[model samples]
Target: MFRKKSVLTFLKAQVAAFLGGITDYGVMILLTEIFKLHFTFSILISGTVGAIINFSINRFWVFKNQSNYSSHINSQLFKFALVVLGSISLKSFGTLIFQKLFQIDYRIGRLITDLFVSYGFNYPLIKYWVFRINEKQNAIQSN
Candidate 1:
């Protein structure tokens, strides 16, 4: 059941996310630990980098659409910005809830942000809605 193309697409997305995460971690470390940037700013920079990487990989490899690159890129970027906005909101809420309500550490709050904001809700929404280049057309053609 493991077709090559599907497997490759999945692997490419996973690799992109992993590399993006590493890139994000580096930026966070530099901004937070070295440059003494605010936690929010560091998170924004790291998350933006990761989102760019994810968008690039998904557009070129996973979707493989034949649309105009410029237009596709613009729309994808817009959608990504929305997703990032949602992620940041969720992260801030998670941090407040964890620290104030549960007396949890901010690191755990970050973990909550990572899971709910980025991985869980955002991934599927971006995959199916935000970056869905050929969605309606594909549906029409298939029918």
Candidate 2:
């Protein structure tokens, strides 16, 4: 059963991601242009900051998972961290490959890489694994 709620939730998550992306890009620009930081290091820090924002919004707002945060937050955070670490690796390498092999601009390459990583990897893993509804909760809600 394809619920409309699921679609709406996804849309909201996308919006949250878009906002987080702006934060990420802003930090990268600030570090690189204002502070003269290296591009790769800027990306590393900015991406981690952005992932923190994305995780907060997705956990509280987008997914609306009612799990006991006090008891489960650490576990959830660990899983989310794993996913973000993988995403960071994918994005960093993907952007480098696109720029070097295809002669794309770094910004453009990053955009493309972000799109692919967010949709192809992040969304699915976050939805099904990180914020998955517990079976007991699901059964209770169903009944």
Which candidate number maximizes lDDT?
A: 2
Q: What is the C-alpha lDDT of each candidate?
A: 0.69, 0.86
Which stretches of model 2 miss by more than 4 angstroms? 139-143
Clashes of 1: 0
How far residue 95's Cα lies from its native spot in candidate 2, in Å, is 1.2
Model 1 residue runs over 4 Å out of place are 1-11, 99-105, 133-143
Tens digits of per-residue lDDT, candidate 1, 1-143, equal 33985577557666766776667657766887889986567777877887777777776666654366688668777887898777766765676688779988655666666666656767677677776646575665347
Model 2, residue 5: C-alpha shift (Å): 1.3
Please report the candidate that would top TM-score against the real structure.
2
C-alpha-based local distance difference test score of model 2: 0.86
Instruction: Write down the TM-score of every candidate.
Output: 0.72, 0.89
Clashing pairs in 1: none
Clashes of each: 0, 0
Error of 1 at 48 (Å): 1.5
